[model samples]
Target chain A: MAGYGTARQDHLRRLRRIEGQTRGLQRMVDDDKYCIDILTQVSAVTSALQSFALSLLEEHLAHCVAEATRNGGPEAQEKIKEASDAIGRLVRS
Target chain B: MAGYGTARQDHLRRLRRIEGQTRGLQRMVDDDKYCIDILTQVSAVTSALQSFALSLLEEHLAHCVAEATRNGGPEAQEKIKEASDAIGRLVRS
Candidate 1:
């Protein structure tokens, strides 16, 4: 959890900005902005989001799952399951 | 970048565990582990990864992109572009 906190804070900040970018994208749409321009922003937001996600995924694997395995048990197995599901959602999303 | 440091460490830790799970999965495959069991582990890793990604995206939106927008300029737009592209990759990957 301690590991998650700092990371969580960082993620929160990034998300907020992405939120604004999304709004801007909406405005661009509303104002009849150029297709390329809108697409460009869309691409940017997407990349930003991916980078953020990557960071988190990395941590979950390193800390959470690793700790579980080290501790050893059914819970560790459960943790592994949980992590895999998360990746699936990310890919699909 | 300062914000990224603590977050990065957390991510690294999680990644290590996911890596181990992946190895286990590979072994399971080699050992002819049950299909359901293998898939289940895969799903778990995926979910964990996604959770991590989500957190990072959130931070990017809140801090980096927000700062860019608040500062106001082409850089912000560029940053927006960067972020969007990232999300696109995440979705596709």
Candidate 2:
């Protein structure tokens, strides 16, 4: 797999932040916070994570998929299928 | 605020699934799963949640923002600002 390098670091940071948010959510539930309030926080955390995914997907396209396309043949086809499957998953999610 | 109705239900279902995934993650940790394995599952759950978020964001943009934009004037500006802020947060996340 192609390394994301700097982008990987940024993503890890975001993931760690999201992990903290998830822990906070668990705490909120344990503390019996208002349902609506907890839901709102959940929404925020979801959005943040989604943004991170979008960034990663963008990077994959700009680098991995693009590189595969440039190379052509079976590898390109596989990359295209992978990207399509990913997008399909996102759409149905 | 306008309701998402069926779309809301879909989102809720997806969220519930994600909640289950999160619990599974916790269990994985409790069971002392290998670091790389846990990280792989974490990535999967993160991607699933991100897909859910992206769906919600797309709906918001297509529905709420579009409605506001059609209305024009101060409300339009507010909606536009809201969407921009949301995108900004997603980018920075």
Candidate 3:
């Protein structure tokens, strides 16, 4: 969870930029920009989102997962499993 | 180029949904959603953008590149090289 004031601000800002990039893709399509050019932009946005997700995962592992691991219970296993699944999804996606 | 009426419309619609997905991510972060849930949504958005890129690339191949190939000139090689570079970027990203 990224609810802290500064963390939340950082996420919103990144998402806003990603949203802007998507809008730019729309404009590129509307204007009939070169195919390769549009594809380049799409890759840019995808990479941006990918990096964002990676950082979020790192934070999750550091905070929530780390806390659970410290507690040493069935919940710790559950948290580890959940985080593993999330990482799998990210890689496969 | 996706400047045609229906084709452009389709592209724009897809981008709009991707943008919506991104905004939803912001909301999830703001709401302090579970880390795995946010990560899942991020993967979804990434996959959506990826598929969109693939389709657009298909169209480019079917149209622009196809046309260049039919003409049989250096331009065909250029188009192919450009497309390959774009695909590389997508895969690397």
**Leading candidate by TM-score:** 3
DockQ (Cα-based) for each candidate: 0.10, 0.06, 0.70
Between prediction 2 and prediction 3, the one with superior lDDT is: 3
Estimate the lDDT of model 1. Answer: 0.72
lDDT of 3 by residue, B1-91 (tens): 3423347777889999999999899888888888788899999999999988998888888888989999998999998999999999999
Expressed as tens digits, the lDDT of each residue in A14-52 for candidate 3 is: 899999999999898888888888999998999899888
Q: lDDT score, residue B83, model 3? A: 90
A22-76: candidate 1 lDDT, tens digit per residue: 9999999999999999999998998888778767765664456546655666866
Clashing pairs in 2: none
lDDT of 1 by residue, B1-93 (tens): 743565898888888888998999999999999999999999999877876776676555445655665566687657655755565566776
| Cand. 2 TM to true fold | 0.53
User: What C-alpha lDDT do the candidate models reach, one value each?
Assistant: 0.72, 0.60, 0.87
True contacts kept of each: 0.20, 0.02, 0.86
| Candidate 3 chain A: 10-residue stretch with minimal lDDT | A1-10
Off by over 4 Å in 3: A1-6, B1-6
* Model 2: per-residue Cα lDDT over A41-92, one tens digit each: 6568766655765666676778778887999999999877877767665444
Q: Which stretches of candidate 2 lie over 4 Å from their true place?
A: A1-3, B1-93
